[model samples]
Target: MDKNTIEILFSERKKVGLNLFEIMKEQGYTKISFSNRVKISRPTLNHLFEGEISSITTFEKYLDRIRDVLQVQEQEFLIGRRTAIGELQVAFSCNEPKGYHPGEREKEMFEILEDLINLCDFYY
Candidate 1:
């Protein structure tokens, strides 16, 4: 692939990352938890957001499986009240790094959110 084409692919991959973020947020998934769910490391997910593939071998092992995992996980997550909660504006606004792991408390918040979602799903 030419340099331009490679850059385009990287750009497209970033878009995918953003789309994945939206899906995750709707389902109350922080980056750390999503990485766990996807069975990929947090750094791998960050590299994906940065649109730079660090290891071809790693990609070969896991990249193709992401979609399949997402399908199954999405179904599980969608059992709760799912909707466009809001947008963070990170993609356009943040000038620094794009992906960051949630802190311990933040992760706890996500866990609480997940419990609430489960309750919502169970009740309705």
Candidate 2:
């Protein structure tokens, strides 16, 4: 992805904050409740919802918890067309990279997100 595409993806991700917050609200998750459910500290959850760009690992775990609690499909948590390859490249370039771990839970969650993205690609 080029610089312009990266810039556009970052802009789109910022725009997604409101929609993601709405989804949490729709699921009836108070900040405290969401923190407890997701096993993250309240302050951390606050940072995430307040548009702080957290580690991909942290975000992935949160997304997993949100999907599990809401009983929603993986696509429901995705940012859709806003997910440009540039944004993915940025995420992939995180300074503190996490190697793939095929623990059962991790594998399952990865597969779920992968499948959702693949399905979404059909419409792209």
Candidate 3:
């Protein structure tokens, strides 16, 4: 894609990151807890969430991690939250970051999210 296309996509991704923030808040997920659930460093998670990540690979990697953590489909996390805008965006914001590992229950949640994504793709 051209520079303009890439920029637009990146901007959209940032919006998705913002939406993910709302989801995390609703689910009672703090940066420290989320980083632990995703098994990523706090700084990297913060960079990803804030859209300050310069590397596309890093951005996508953390996005995938977040999708896993939230037990949401990738497309749902990125673009489908428009269906419930008001409920999803209720007074949500965060900046703090800290780290740890994804435990078995968290891994199960990720697997469920992945399965839902695949099921949606298969049916739709």
lDDT of all predictions: 0.55, 0.55, 0.63
Query: Candidate 2 lDDT, tens digit per residue, 19-38?
Result: 45556666677666666777
Residue pairs whose backbone atoms clash in candidate 2:
none
> Candidate 3: which stretches are off by over 4 Å?
1-11, 79-124
Task: Give the better candidate number (2 or 3) by lDDT.
Answer: 3
Tens-digit lDDT track of model 1 for 3-111: 5533443446646455555565656777777788888887777776555675544543454456566564322322333256544222112133568766788778767
Q: What is the lDDT of residue 73 in candidate 3?
A: 66
Q: Ten-residue segment with the worst summed lDDT in candidate 1?
A: 87-96
Q: What TM-score fits each model?
A: 0.44, 0.44, 0.51
Please give the lDDT score for candidate 2: 0.55
What would the TM-score be for candidate 2 when compared with the true structure? 0.44
Query: Model 2 residue 21 lDDT?
Result: 54
State in Å the error of residue 37, model 1.
1.5
Which pairs of residues collide in model 1?
A: none
Q: Put down candidate 3 lDDT per residue, 44-115, tens digits, no spaces.
A: 766665667777655666666676667876555455343444532222223325565667887787777778
In lDDT terms, how accurate is model 3? Answer: 0.63
